[model samples]
Target: MSAEVSGVRIGVEERRARLRARQLAAVDDVAEVVEGLVALHATDPATVFLSVAARLCRPSGAIAAVEEALYGSGSGPGSGPALVRMMAMRRTMFVVSRESAPDVFAAAGRDIAARERTKLLEHLARGGGWDAAWLAEVEAEVEAALDRHGESGGARLSALVPRLREQVVVGRGKPYETTQNVASRVIRVMAAEYRIERRRPAGSWTSGQFRWARAEPLPERPVGPAREAVVRAWLRAYGPGTEADLKWWTGWTLTEVRKALKAVGAETVRLDDGAGHILPGHILPGDTEPAEPPPPGPVLLPGLDPTPMGWQDRDWFLPRSHRAELFDGTGNVGPTVWWGGEVIGGWAQRADGSVVWRQLTDRGAEAAGAVDRAAAELVGLLGGVRITPRFRTPLERELSA
Candidate 1:
């Protein structure tokens, strides 16, 4: 029995790649990495796109480095763009351009807004209110915006009528959706366009009051070769996980996930469930090694960060008891702070972009200090050139007060 247990532990370690392969093969090439991301139909390509795009600050010149890669820049530099498009920068919670949010939205123009709002509201209404005339109005506004902005992704919005109509409703003035609903539908539409296989909608999506809610959905089919390539790439970026973990991260079913695994069967190995929570002998890469755990300092991952929320078996990384605090009733995981490999607390960013974190543990100041530095670093990297760090500490009396 001891020998059998020892062998399984060894196999588990090998699957996690701690045992061999000095230069993790999966992480070797950036180009291949981008291709893999594109293939997975990563839930929010914008997030991954912005993340790698920011690799611009890395020793490799950002544009020069990304230009040669498969995902490349999804939105090339342009004059002005819309909030939805500009919000893409928010995926990283940082924008690389000097343009203010208003400027970006202004560039998006009222027409683009009309269309996005139209499409968004339609989904909120759930196939009501949005009509041919409403859509036509939005289309006209979109064309005018294109003429003003001189051609951008927003311009392509004019051509996505079929998809737009499928997801939204054209109704009377102010279509029946709320701000949250609009935000949700925009993400959903983008995911669909990215061809991501899974997107689960928030519970509010069913509430008539909510025109839309951002939740992941399970794609009709696991993404094909190109998309599969991206899924494999995600494993490299965020792996040492089980097949169930991948399914949880992307909202695909076990059956579809298994098929996708078969697609990449040659590159992975199975890990025995030494943890006992997940199935034993789960597939992980034999040559994969855990990335050195991220520095012990605190880092503020954006509200919709893919890291903590990436795997289904979140308890493996997070304490099961505190899960409810971060995950809402609708299953949305908000902005969270990480200290070492475990989550320490929740955070919210105010209008000035100052970050306020509520620690669930005593690591508050220690973690906040690190997150403060990281936020400043990211903000500066995004074109602020210089960003000041400010941490909000909740007073003990205030808790009782």
Candidate 2:
């Protein structure tokens, strides 16, 4: 066993400041923020666009820019997307830079794909007349259908693949059991494998409805090296994270987390909360102050923004007392108000497309004023498109209602 390194410290305030410089600081490129923040949480659909807007110096064109990166036809025709939406760590959806998608998939997405396929197979087994062979046949047919007819909505694809329209009963013995068509699940599996991707919105960018198309194959990578690469990327943005933080964020086993940390040369450090670890040189032995410390931000981050979801242990940026109001029961975050890099409150979009906010804890008049400006800026950024977080928290729901 290797020896450990300790006696080093990164306090809450420093961590907050680091966060501002690393992620909260404004940038011009959409892809830059995506990679810099590791990846943007995309389950909510709107989260990716909002997260990008939050980081841009001028955000008026954020939605168009993001859409182009994801579905752009390139400089000419038939060129691929610059970013990829994948099932990532913790079985969640995220948008990652195209170059990083392979490692992201190898380290996190592949296992999730395997689990989803297995679960679907098990459900089919319970229903009978459906097995792995049947599932594979349907998958191939769906792929061919998408190719033959170009991209298609789920219902349209289902109509094209007659076999896919059949329903399966899930949770047969449970009170909340329901039937679901196989089209979506099969498409989900293919998406997880990078065999296909969502091509375009059936409605607005905020709409979950999407057309499906065959996706470019992800670059192949070794799992071990990829895990190390992913951990390194995480640490570059969210180092000093505890083992639990890495493990929980990745949905990897504790053993995998430990092995990857060792491979990445992570060193133990003391956080304000407890013992944590950071990549070597993450905090220099005697690192000097940045030429300029980040301002007390009052940045408004959307719910499920990558920074808030980057780690399982959030004490450095999120206070324990605000946990209940800020997150849904299952741990999805709500739109947050931040100042000095710490999450200070929540915000919501009202029925009239207005953005309203309230502080969970006071950071004073100056911070509040700054947050007010940020809110007004968000209102202009939104431009009357009402966005409801897919997962609503108590605070957001109350504010919106």
Candidate 3:
């Protein structure tokens, strides 16, 4: 005979309302989002970088908006060439949500194209070397051909030549390798008819990937707003986080982050995390998790998702000491496989969409089966409608208790 009364039971609706309120508070307009990141930078530099990246590169966001803000006028490098050079050194990789890859590529391509033209013309004027004269001659020819095409679809190819050349140089490691190299280098020059860089002829596509001909020099100016937007976005995705947390994610200085945050006023909130420390608002729920959070789904998060890499005090979801285990040297979070709110494993998909998983520990076949389901879910996100499990690796056999 069991008739038991609970010590403390809160109605589910009440908990949901509280949680919803906290989540809703985190919802911010694009502008507000921008402001918050500026503030975030003030408190934590690295975090601002990561947060901004998260914003510009969500599963469904655009890079152009942020790009313009950074390079358009304010604090960022105003010159396109300088911006490209600067961005090149920014080696930090941001994951382009699988769905937004097209748009991201387009925007990045535009930036690449504009910067290449300027670089070509400027480099030619400066008299770099052999590649310069050849590039200059090619620009003239390409422009003449474009004149015939009357700036239509064909001109796009003309415009794109310089871009392709730039990619080749960057990817291939040498500018004058063979006929293909000479052709690409000359094509870019002919298309632009503007002076070209002899030492740094732009590159082109090879085997699919675009290569950077010459090392992109660092950006000449600060990409303020654009950078700020990226920071804000990260916080939105993984907030209620500390400025230090933000710093760990971004690579900016605390001073820069502070300036950005100051720009964003009440739109951003600072909440205490039980301790005296204040952090971004979203991560801190006014209430605790209901006996359960959502039933863990098999979600295949992009390599750059904020969910896994955004927080600094990750003990809530992961063992704090091992946080570095999931991250690479550049602070890029690897692809993570999740069963619930926490990460249980990691997976990778080859270009062909073959799925492979590596579990953190041996959980046996039952766990292996769950990973299979999760991998399928991930493949769907990557545009592959269906995925077949090819293989799995367990870190070690079941440990003796």
Highest lDDT model number? 2
Model 3 per-residue lDDT tens digits across residues 304-335 = 44455455555544444444545555555555
Write the candidate numbers in order of decreasing TM-score: 2, 1, 3
Per-prediction CA RMSD (Å): 12.0, 2.8, 14.0
In order, the Cα lDDT scores of the candidates are: 0.40, 0.83, 0.39
- How should the candidates be ordered by lDDT, best one leading? 2, 1, 3
The residue pairs found clashing in candidate 2 are none
- Locate the minimum summed-lDDT window of 10 residues in model 2: 279-288
Over 111-146, each residue of candidate 2 has an lDDT whose tens digit, in order, gives 889998898888788854599889889889988998
- State which candidate, 2 or 3, has the greater lDDT: 2
* Location of the lowest summed lDDT over 10 successive residues in candidate 1: 204-213
Model 3 TM-score?
0.42
Candidate 2: segments with Cα more than 4 A from true spot? 74-79, 171-178, 274-292
